[model samples]
Target: MRKIYVIGIGAGDPDHLTLQAAKAIGRTNVFFLIDKGEAKQSLVDLRERIIRAYSHPHKRIVEGRDPDRDRTPADYTGTIADWRHRRSQVFEELISEHLREDEIGAFLVWGDPSLYDSTIAILDEILERGEATFEYEVIPGISSVSALAAKHRVGLNRVGQPFQITTGRRLAEGWPEGVDDVVVMLDAQQAFTAHPEAEIYWGAYVSTEDELLASGRVADVAEEIVKTRAEARERHGWIMDTYLLRRRPTTDD
Candidate 1:
């Protein structure tokens, strides 16, 4: 059977690769890469470094052009569904054309595959379509959630409080019903600014050479983060950032 390994390579740093993920890289015959474009080529470069240092010379690299989607759209679910369909089509084609029945293929993902990343969802679409017959396994790597917490030297949760993980879009809708400790990812707007009373631990380009980190009461640091984010985005042509927001525990306990 043709086998596929969807490996998580971590957030922006080659060193974030787990040994298990590296071993999977060495075993893969064809590595399928989704090119997200030149602006975010720093990510592709990190993946390349890991692949170069570990994979055997006989291994191959296959590039799949990532389909573009509206970053902010009124029809969020519809936009994503259409985009995922296109991505599944591209991935299915790549797997069918280059992956032989007995050989293995791999997709190196940023952070953990189970996070906000879409490779797993796209692969599920490919499977449901029955265009490619392959066995696959997921290798989890350190997610930005963990990296962010580490960089900020803080735990995700307070004493007995639970933590919430969500996207900036969800955050804009207002805080989740019952959580005071929240980790927000893919937040272009620094949504934490809306809840300035909360303390925030924010980081950008995490674990990379251009890494930037800030922590303080949201009201105190929100403007600085916005400015830093703009400057970093202009300098690198892209930005990947996440933040944790923690408020005083309420009686919901």
Candidate 2:
């Protein structure tokens, strides 16, 4: 049976690559990647640097074009589902053609596979189709959420309290009930701007050289964050950011 490893490369910083991930890279026979086009070439460069630094000298590399999808689709969930299906097809084809029965292959994931990433799900879909058969394992790595909290030097939640992790779209709709602390990711919408009362610990491209961080009362810093985010996105052509929002306790509590 062929074996596959889904390794988390961490949040862009090469030093964030864990020892287990490095060992996995060294043992791999082939590395598979999805090229996200020229606009995000920095991401491609980072992945290449990691592979070259740790992967065995004889390991083969395979690349596939990322499927294009509507960035602002009316049906967001449906659109992403379709895109993931196309990606699974690409990965399935690559595995079938490149991986030998005895060889091991891998997909280097950004952050932990179990987080917001869809690589593990895509691999599962390919397996369910029964077109390719391989047993896989996931190696966890430091996620942007963790990196954000570390960079800001704040706990995700208050003592004995719970915290929620959600997307920017959900946060924009409304703050979640029963939770004072929320971590937002994939927020193209800068949803924190809606709740000006909360304190925001925000960071863009956390752990990388081009990192930018800002934290303060949302009312005071939201404008600055919005401007900084726009400039960074324009400069790099892409950005990956996450922020933690903590709502202050009220007299009722």
Candidate 3:
């Protein structure tokens, strides 16, 4: 039977790749990478750098597009389900062309598979439909949350406190109740505006030389971050950013 290995490549730093992830890449017969068009060539370039440094000669690289799912609808869950379905179709087509029953197919994920990533979900759907019979494994890599904390020199949570991981859309809807610390991702909406009472530590292209790091009251830095993010996206044609927000404790109950 064939086996699929989903390896997290980490946030940006190639050194963040775990030994196990590198080993999996080296053993892969066919490795698939996603291309978000020419505008985001850096992503593909970064993947190539990692493969060149670690992948063996026997391993072949295949490029594919991530499914484009409509997100304008309020149905976040349904959007993701449809997105995963489309991704599974792309994976099936790619694997059919190169994967063999006895060979190992690999995919390099951006950050740990368990985190906001949907690659594993697509694979699961494929397996559930009996479209593919393959053993699967996910090798964890450094997450953007860890990278953000390290870059900002702050722990994700305070002593005995809990934190939440959410997306920009939810934040725009409203701050989640009962969470003091929140790590926000996929924030195209600049949701920081909704939480004026929070402090923000934001980073764009973390761990890369072009990184932009800023922190201060969310209200103070919200516009700056929005403008900077736009400029950076215009200059680079793409951006991957994340931020941490902590609700300041007020004296009043």
Name the lDDT value of residue 108 in candidate 1. Answer: 90
Give candidate 2 regions above 4 Å deviation: 250-253
Per model, state how many residue pairs clash. 0, 0, 0
- In angstroms, the error of model 2 at 62 is 0.6
Q: Rank the candidates by lDDT, best first.
A: 2, 1, 3
Top model by lDDT, which number? 2
Give the clashing residue pairs of candidate 1, or none. Answer: none
Q: Model 1: per-residue lDDT, tens digit, 104-202?
A: 999998899999988888888888878688889999988988999999999998777788999998999999977889999988777788998999999
What local distance difference test score does each model get? 0.90, 0.93, 0.87
Per-residue accuracy of model 3 over 1-253 as CA lDDT, tens digit each: 8999999889889999999998888888888888777888888898899999988876788888977777576887888788788888999888878898899998888878899988888888888888668888989989988999999999888766778999998888888787788999999889888887799999999977788999989889889999999999999988889999998643222
Superior candidate under lDDT, 1 versus 2: 2
Sorted on TM-score, highest at the top, how do the candidates line up? 2, 1, 3
Q: Per-residue CA lDDT of candidate 2, range 1-253, in tens?
A: 9999999999878999999999999999999988999998788788889999998889999998899999999999999999999999999999999999989999999888899998999999999999899999999999999999999999998877889999999998999988999999999989999999999999999999999999999999999999999999999899999999999854233
